[model samples]
Target chain A: MRADYLILGNSAAGVSAAEAIRATDSCGSIVIASPEPHRVYGRPLISYLLEGKTSLERIGYKNADFYERLNIEPFLGPGYDAMRLDANAHRATFSNGTEIEYGRCLIATGSIPFTPPIEGLDEAQNVTPFLTLDNALKAQELADRARAAAHAEGRESRAIVIGAGLIGLKAAEAISHSVDRVMVLELAPRILPAVLDAEGARLLQGMLARHGIECRPGVSAQKILVDGGTAHGALLTDGTEEPCDFIVAAVGVRPNTAFAVEAGATQGRGLVCGPDLQTSLPDVYAAGDVVQVRDALDGTERPLALWPNAVRQGMIAGRHMADDPLAPVFDGSFAVNAVDFFEASLLTAGLINPPDNAEGVTCDVRIDEAAGTYAKFVVRDGKLAGYILLNRPDNAGIYTWLIEHETQLDTIDPALFDSAPLNCDFDKTMRWERLHAGYPADRNEKGFLVKRECPSAS
Target chain B: MKRIYAIEAWCLGCKRCEIACKTQHSATRDTVKALTQEQPSPTSRVQVEGDRFLSLAVNCRHCAQPKCVKGCISGAMQKDPASGLVTSDPAKCVGCRTCVSMCPFGCVQVVSVEGRDIALKCDLCTEDGCIPGEPACVAACPNGALVYWESEE
Candidate 1:
């Protein structure tokens, strides 16, 4: 097979790159290959699927006719394995003995769930790793069985979820309604330790407790207690045992960069890409969770495994591949997390909790423990560095924009923290310029006059 | 791409734009009846901000790169490539409010309908039987503070 652009892993990044390619090079042949048989779907909705909040048909991120409308070919299913990149020949070979020549290629294999070496895990049944649609389906089936068995025995079912990160908490939240009790065990001292501070985690833990989900931080699962070849419980490191019928390991994920590394592409935590998302090898690019991007807040490189970053990186890579002159430069990437758990909304962006010894960094925190609302801002040199909004997150994007643009706080109104930041927060002249500049003149037929206000002369 | 532009200097702060937007989006489409109806009450998507002398009517910009579209978990909030309009499908919405937190303009609103919350944003009065260039708020603005026009790219 031959194509002008070949993309691996037909998920968010791969599909985005294909769309971007089609936008610039209309007639270029684009092919997307993936081990998953289904078309591109929302990976984040898998948790919603387990909770029965959504159906498989509705989980698709793009429309069914997306590929057809974009005029891109798809090579889906598990037939393709072991992608080997030949930089010299500008081609790639699959384990099934098929080869495809490409003018440019993108590696967006995403990430795989990392299962720790817990004793008796391989021999345990009813244990699933929460990721992908297939894993969700399997977990749902096992949960249903456990529920029915509990109902038959006139009792309630229990489930144990390992890890307390975003994935683990989401899994616990999804299945909480179905199961009688869901225990979330985390080795870290607090839940969402990567993104949330200790106080933030404590607030969230209180909310989870009210909803009947037990969160045990600083605890590890030593072994999966299997009875009759079926997993029934977990032995904790604290000399305790948690009884359960099902277990979901949401510990963490590692980038799938083995193929790229084998092909001589440099790797840090993930495949190292230049500012253009190109790897060391010519004509080979990487995006999504498999690639490391520079952090905008701090001048450091890290694997930002967020969906929006993946889409943006893929678009930039695609534009570069197409040689589009107007291609937007990849500046930097940061983390943005939004989650709604049990009616409590939370949003966190950039560095929520900077290190204690960080120079010239200060923090302003507002905590309303009774109302379960917490707002904190980490500022450095009068610039908005990071923020965490809990419960009342209205206009949270303003903080995100401030952080992303590195806008100096002194330039804006001092009352920004007092209320929700709105467009009115800026000076009237700046606001007018931002709202009206480049806007087209209104047609006289609409009974309105189009007038351009000159801010410079005023 | 056609978009609604706000003239802050000309806004009267009368909030007529808000009433017009709410009435246009209502099920009745009649000013008096729509305001009186108890079931499925309409919520205005456009907001009037600032004081009397300096105020602006703000609504969804329908951005080219909408963060709400990216953060939407259910894939309900979508930006139409052809029309350049970002809209939400209520049938597919799970009322997560990810869009509410993600909109840079703070335009997306979460309204409770029959005890279930769903996101509401300016649809350019597309559902109100208005033409492409005649949004209800634009037509209702007597001061010519709001205008809808197509911009040449």
Candidate 2:
């Protein structure tokens, strides 16, 4: 198959790229290939399904006619086993025994959940990695069975989730309502060690505990205790055995960059991309969870595996591929995490906790444990390096905007942190500009803000 | 695409725009009835924000790149392609307040009716066969503080 644009993977990034391409170049033939049969759906909503907060029908990110509306051909089912890219010919050959010639191509295969090499884990039937929709469905079925068994035995259904990261916590939260008990195991000293500081983690752990979810920090699962080819529990490093009928392994995710690496794309944690999201190979681009871009907080290049970043990168990749004059230059990417755990909403942006030894790194923390509110601001050289807002997360966009724009902290009104940052918090000139300026009108000629077309206008 | 623009200097802070917006969005079109109805008070999407010197009637800017829509997980919040209007579908909204947190302008709010919560924002008064060009808030502005018109690029 020959097309003007060939996109691999059909999740957030791939769908976004295809939609972006269709926006500028309506005549171009865009083909999206994915192993999943269904059209694009929000991956994060899978947990909501387990929690019964949302139904499968409402989980779809786009409407049923999304692909039809965009007029993009979809090649679904059968994962792309192999990819051979001919840089000179601008052609890609997939393992499905098909060759496609394209003007531009994008790789947005996203990531796969990492399951640790725990003894008996691979052989256990009840252990599943909670990442994809299939995994969620399978886990849900297992949970149902476990619940039924527990009911019949007049006992509580216990579930073990390894890793206290975002996914694990979400999984635990989702199944907590359905199961009798949920235990979260983490190797780190605190929960959400990557995103939350020690204080922030402690607050979240307390909230989790209040909701009856057990959190074991600084403990690792030594082995999955299996009986008759089924996982019944796990042996912890601390020599404790927890009974669990179902287990969810959500340690972390590694970029699915085997195709790009095989195609000679240089990778460091993820496929390395230029400012335009182009890979080392000609006519090849990478975005979403599979690409490493410059971090806005620090200068280091790394993979920012977040939904907003993926969508932004994908849109940029599409614009670049289509040769749109308005193609946005990726100024830099940073990590932003927003989640709700037991009615406590948390928003973390940029570097939550910079190393104590790092020069000029200062932190301002406010903790109201009784009210379940914690706000921490990490700053360096009069600029906001990062912030973590718990419970009172109103108007977090202002802080995120400041961090993204690298606005000097001194320039902003001090009253911002006191209350949720509002239009009144900004200087008069900035307030006027933000209020009057049309979307994207305030963006500069280049860098991050550029090429961010209004979803409607595009 | 036409959008509501705030003329900060002209705003009298009479809060008439807020009242008009609430009535238009309420179940009843009557201003007195909407405000006085028992349980689930009417909400005004437009706000007169400022002290004495300068007050701007602020509503949804209907951003070109709406962070609210992007942050919305339930796909409840959407920017209409043809109209360039950002609106929220209350039925689909899970009231996660993700949009409320992400909206830079602080336009999206979580409004509770009885015990159920839904995201309430300016929908440009498009419901119930309201005229396309006429928004209740913009029309009720006595001064030329708020205007709904197409901006020249």
Q: How many backbone clashes are present in model 1?
A: 0
**Least lDDT summed over 10 consecutive residues: which range in candidate 2 chain A?**
A439-448
Which predicted model would earn the best lDDT? 1
Per-residue accuracy of model 1 over A1-458 as CA lDDT, tens digit each: 89999898888788888888998999999989888888888787788777665678878878889999999898888876547888889888886778999999999889988888989776877888887888887878888889999889998899999999988898899888888899999999999998899999999998998998999999989998998889999999898988998998899999987887998999998888888889888999888988877888876887888777787788888998899899887877788887778788888888888999789898889888887799888998888888888886777887887887787888788677765778888776666654554465443323355675668954
Q: Which candidate is the best by TM-score?
A: 1
Over the stretch A1-458, how does candidate 2's per-residue lDDT look in tens digits?
A: 69999998888789888988998999999999877777787787788778766678877888789889999998887755336777678887777778888888899989887767889989888988988888899889988999999999999999999999999999999888888899999999999998899988888898899898999999989999998999999899999998898999999999888767876889987888888889998889988999987787787877888777788888889999988899989777788777887688888888887887789888888888788899999888888889999887766877877777777877677887876777766777787777776533543312123555468854
Docking class of 1: medium
True contacts kept of 2: 0.30
Summing lDDT over every window of 10 consecutive residues in candidate 1 chain A, give the lowest-scoring window. A440-449
TM-score, per-candidate, Cα-based = 0.93, 0.91
